[model samples]
Target: MRWFRKKSASTTKTIFGEYCATSSVHGVRYFSDPERTLCEKFWWIVMFLVSVGGCVKLIESTWLKWNLTPIVVNFENQPISVTEIPFPSFTICPPGKISKLMYNFAKEAKQIRNSGAHANAYGSEDCFSTEFE
Candidate 1:
């Protein structure tokens, strides 16, 4: 009886040579290649920078739109009286006063939305929509 069988050429090349060779399968080679890995990392960094820049530009534009069109309120029309209160407590205004405050805010918002510069900056007339009507 033969105790150990002879190694076959086909099995030897397929198992040992392919597995232990410097180059691997196509998928593994693509990922393991240093140049390809560096390229991928470079693209990832570029995409990150682009996204951050886009966000910054959006925030800056919005700020500029708001700053350019100031909200000028007539304090005489809706007077706000401040009342001092005790420590650890707060003073509450009447319901009418709160309603007036909300109405004033809505009016100013409508004016800003109707302004040509602000409307054009936002690219839409209903950008700052409020249900305070």
Candidate 2:
């Protein structure tokens, strides 16, 4: 009983300390990001949305990129080159594995996806269909 009491007290202190040190709401730490970075925050958001899948498509309809590329100048409109967009930005990750740079890359990728840089980018319905199918 004495050992149990000591163990519980220590565990409680550890958890409370962590919560106090981080930004949290409702006793739930939203961002445990010890090393703050724009990319990490963005990726957190991306991962959250992607987990919902359908809602992510609705919240940010341009997050999905099924082999989508960036756009550059074209015959009529000389837009940015979709094919030449940098790496790590235009790709999705397998959750909790996203890096800050990859999140940055994903942002640009999402923009390109929205801009129809790829002639065959997946639509909302199409994207959901593929995910489950």
Candidate 3:
């Protein structure tokens, strides 16, 4: 701590000290490098805050992209088995909508079957696979 003193009894002050004493302590004159002082004072504070914010944003973006994004993957394109989901014990509502949907699917499937090989050769809308439906 003693060694950190600006001046010792025997040592003479250098030009830098004389400049500091004249301009900073006694004189009203200021240095031209205002931005240097501003940066020196605020650099670490700004950089640390920005880095912390960036890390938080990075974590948030990763979570959104991976977990929050709604991905509608086609089961036919992948090798993953589709039988893993646990069936609900009870229906949330009446089963009329389900029965109607099944009836429509059966009717459409029957129509496809009735429209035979002639339908496939001349690519009509009726000839398309049930996947299009």
Candidate 4:
């Protein structure tokens, strides 16, 4: 199988050459023409303002339909209850209280270590057992 095939022809003519060439004429003239008339500038400004207004209207309608309208409908159908909603509540402990709790935890951990309870809790005797096999 041939991996790299050379193109048969150079300077190939495209079927839509006229369409592409005609389409670029307006864009090229709009950008490259320095001596534009006042009428052209006014026309461009009108087009820009109209486009912006259209975009704003589109966004407003979309927001109303997708976001605001649904919220309003939901509120009208089923009113929100404070007790039914599970709002997050935080218990803010002082730094001193947190430190005291940590100290107590460490003391209990040290006692468990001294009593050999921590070693037995790990069940190290089962480490070499082949009970599963």
Index of the highest-lDDT prediction: 1
TM-score of each: 0.29, 0.21, 0.25, 0.29
Lowest lDDT block of 10, candidate 4: 6-15
Q: How do the candidates rank by lDDT, highest first?
A: 1, 2, 3, 4
lDDT tens digits by residue: candidate 4, 16-49:
3334345553332332234667677567657767
Q: In model 2, which regions exceed 4 Å deviation?
A: 1-9, 16-63, 76-133
Candidate 2 lDDT, 26-63, residue by residue in tens: 32343344565767656766676666797666656454
**lDDT, model 1, position 8:** 64
lDDT of each: 0.60, 0.57, 0.55, 0.54
The candidate 1 region of ten consecutive residues with least summed lDDT is 24-33
On a 0 to 1 TM-score scale, where does candidate 3 land against the true structure? 0.25
2 versus 3: better lDDT goes to? 2
lDDT of 2 at 107: 59
Ten-residue stretch with the least lDDT total in model 2: 124-133
lDDT of 3 by residue, 1-133 (tens): 5775645632444544456446643221222233347555366446656778999999989988977654445446564433554455974866655666555666665566566753776666455545524
What is the Å distance of residue 78 in model 4 from its true position? 9.7
Total clashes in model 3, counting residue pairs 3 or more apart in sequence or in different chains: 0
| Model 1 global lDDT (CA atoms, 0 to 1) | 0.60
Colliding pairs, model 4: none
